[model samples]
Target: MTQHLANFKARPVACVTGATRGIGRDIALHLAAQGYDIAFGFRDEIHASNLQEELVALGAKVFCQPLNLFDAKSINSFFDSLNTAQFGLDLLVNNAGITKDNLLAMMSQEELEQVIHVNLIAPILCAQAALKIMLPQKQGCIINMSSISATKPNPGQTNYAASKAGIEGFTRALAVEVARKNIRVNCIAPGIIETDMVSDLLKGNEQQAKSKLLSKRLGKPRDISALVAYLASQQAEFISGEVFNVNGGMLLR
Candidate 1:
């Protein structure tokens, strides 16, 4: 048992939210391949279970739990359970986010608050929870997912943009607060990725969107996942409090 505990402590762990699909799923898989045990939370139990099996098959110990981003109680319970797990957390990837796009004039209060709760509030809470464990260990890495919309807003995306912009600001501020403790915080702003979440946005304007990208193609989850892996690695130890863009050159700012 002592040897087993030592082995468990030797392997790094990563907790990824909304990790059953899209960019979140890719990040979890990429990290598992890099030898990190995975702990993931998702709203869909069946999907999360299947993903757990897949990750386990990849030779990484996997943990899956239910998460309701709308519920603060649920978020707290998740981190509490994670802190008790055998694998110690060394990285956190806040990949879960939602967008309710509508012109401000037509947007209902419910829509605005829901988007803000999931995109901005929940991530902030998760980061706080992770810091509880990370600070004691004197090391950890946090990667928050932002979007191109955060900087370049399109019509009918005011709430979405605002929430993401908050993510960038929070990431920067938190990085400073935790840098002295050996914790690195960073943000990623992805451009038009070909995920189901954005399928509608690309429906009739696929060609038009492609034209705007210097790469002339939509970004893939792998593109973002690769960068995430780099940031979580020791090579990026000097990098923190910065936002990296994987937008296929769609925006130059």
Candidate 2:
């Protein structure tokens, strides 16, 4: 069950996956601050518990549980757990992803499948479930997280690139199908952000990372989270089926 404010019963609700840390964690906090009740999936209770406390402090109702993105049933169960009648599902953010970097010649079959399943398939299933709830309400927004790698491939990230590319395509096509229902789908392509997921690439070399971007600075989690907040708000009602690149002008071509 979720802990909530007394008057939270009427607030908008959003479900964000892979929210235990990094971009996902910040997005959840940002949404809560913006007055949206929050729901998220996690693999670690410690992280989930900490996040729950943070959300509650922001006057938000939180629905969170352990989630295994590789399993379809698990994904469905996460969405099912939300109380659609009481709070309403207004936004879905598919921000969970993984990267197993290795040269294609040395990459394992298992590696490819794991990355693809979590990064790509998981979001498709999430959208499928969220759409079921949104279509009926005739008002919802789905924001899929993609990466610059989807367009500008990096060495030893073939699987990661493929998965993210699929997400971009998925957002566009799905947005068209649900546009008439007033449900908008959009994708975000973040350049290299300073998060644990990509800390290895950053590796205490802020100057080096900044050198590669036109902004001459590494992107922060809040950079992406800010756009997410806008995209989920009424101000972005007219925006959909598009991808916003938040990589400080990183070269994608």
In terms of lDDT, the best-performing candidate is: 2
lDDT of 1 by residue, 37-99 (tens): 888877777777778877878888776677788888888878787676635689999999887
- What value does the lDDT take at residue 108 in candidate 2? 99
User: What's the residue-level lDDT of 225 in candidate 2?
Assistant: 91
Candidate 2, poorest ten consecutive residues by summed lDDT:
1-10
Model 1 clash count equals 0
Residues 23-85, candidate 2, lDDT per residue (tens digit)? 999999999999898988888888888999999899888777778999999888877766444
Every model's TM-score: 0.95, 0.94
Clashing pairs in 2: none
The global Cα lDDT (0 to 1) of model 2 is 0.88
| Model 1 TM-score, 2 decimals | 0.95
lDDT of 2 at 144: 99
Task: Please state the error at residue 51 of candidate 1 in Å.
Answer: 0.7
For model 1, what is the C-alpha lDDT against the true structure? 0.87
